[model samples]
Target: MPSHGAWLKVGGAMARVIHVFRHPDRFVSGTVGEPGERTFYLQASSESKQVSVTLEKQQLTVLSERLTSLLEEVASRFDTEVPPSAPEELTDTDPLDVPVEEEFRVGTMGLGWDAESSSVVIELLAITEGEVDENIVLDDTEEGPDAVRVFLSPAHARAFAERAERVINAGRKPCPLCDEPLDPEGHICPRQNGFLRDNPFTEG
Candidate 1:
């Protein structure tokens, strides 16, 4: 068991839980507090990208031991291993085009409490409506094969909504009515009222 002193303060914020985790990076597993405030840190020599778990004083004594064992189990499934700082073999490959990302539906919603900041973040919205605060909102819709609906964290979701006013300013000129690339010269869009389709895409 960890000692009572293992628990530490994160910041000045008197968050109810103790702290909160934000900007959930690709390199860390997310965790939050249950009842009391807790600290978080990286386990040395661990193969995980980064893991955030509560650090209570009581768990301090056995923290490394318990974490190591648990990390091993997780390592088997993901990339977790202790190896040389630099790999024996490394290579340089040609520049590949941008990777295409397929659209995926968020079938479920997840909630994680941040013990550091004492705030909560919501993820993966599936239900049309959840018993959450009015300050939070999530709405997703399936438009078509070429378009998708995205719900943001409200802090930064306004930059790219697929509304008419937004589309005009966005430089995303592909007509929704016509897959045909919008050309000011005159497009085949029925909505264009016979506007000419002028495309800069030239072929050799």
Candidate 2:
């Protein structure tokens, strides 16, 4: 997706805010597991606070793609080049760290850029249970919805954009016929009219 050339604000003010981390030094998405069992995570950190949230494969894919487009727009508008940086290759790597607890499953997301700070802002909104009260108002000092706000420098954002794409594409290979992920055991290819397809690339 191409950038909209404008930042879009998402979510309403009524939801209960959970956590917000601003100007985080680190924000990256990673996954754990084999093929179908993979669990995606979006982790962020600063000097004092750290946050990690679980997200679905689809959400991760969208976030990565949108960030890429947003960065492209910023580069064009500012006539600046976004340099390539390898975040995963950096040493002193902060471990996903304790309290890697899943704060909330991300349901929706928003992105923007702060020209003053030359940083990209990404917001992850929570998945709420039950119907939300549209009229609910949060106190000025109160944190709203189980959300996470992160600020990423252009270079870091570029790094994340690259890393996210890598993680997302590392999933199981898809069936050539149907374009659906192939299971390790076997798969009934829809294009083959339910013919069982064995893993030709792996030993049975």
Candidate 3:
């Protein structure tokens, strides 16, 4: 079993620490807290090692959308047989794993398809106060920010994206007129000149 954490050395100094899950048993996106106040997370586990990283809701949404698009491109360009949707049996709806201690806040994410393994590779780098090096986003460089790397099968990738979409939509209802999230009390629609309007789409 690989260590839960691995450190790299750069120029006689400690470099970034990376957690790599070559064949994760499970990987999914989840959240903690209520709809409007949710904190999104991406969790991956294999055997005894479980890692969770925090990201913005919009980031998760983009990741899900890009995963689908990447699969489509793979199928079209490489003649790969990618599933149109995740298999029902593999659908995961469980909450985030226990002890969801965030290792880091993700600042940069990288996604790619590994042809040799026929897997989707997702890399998440820790947020830095300064600008990030573009090469470190995906490359295995000794000097870079901490990162979590998970390689998923096409089926698992599809499942992850599907679950992510569901989690994102489970948030607060959006205002029909302005497309903004509606408060529990009601939404003041800017489009309607700050007038409070009842959202027909949301059930009372």
All candidates: TM-score: 0.18, 0.65, 0.82
Residues 1-204, candidate 3, lDDT per residue (tens digit)?
133568878777887888989869899999998755788999999999999999998899899999999988888988567788999988998888899999999999999988888889899999999999887766777777899988888888999999998888777687878888675567799999999987544421
lDDT of 3: 0.85
Model 2, 1-204: lDDT tens per residue? 112111223454354444545556668887766665778889887777677889888788788888888888888898566765544554223435665778778866778787766788887767776543333221112333456777667778888787777677667677888977666678899899998998554311
Q: lDDT: which is higher, 1 or 2?
A: 2
**Model 1, 123-202: lDDT tens per residue?**
33222344533223222112111111121221211111112122222233566667654544446666677666565532
lDDT: which candidate is best?
3
| Residue 138, candidate 1: C-alpha displacement in angstroms | 22
| Pairwise TM-score winner, candidates 1 and 2 | 2
Off by over 4 Å in 3: 1-5, 11-13, 174-204
TM-score of 1: 0.18
Which regions of candidate 1 fall more than 4 Å away from where they truly are?
1-15, 21-58, 80-204
Superposition-based RMSD of candidate 3 using all C-alpha atoms, in angstroms:
5.2
Local accuracy by lDDT, each model: 0.27, 0.67, 0.85
Candidate 2 lDDT for residue 49: 69
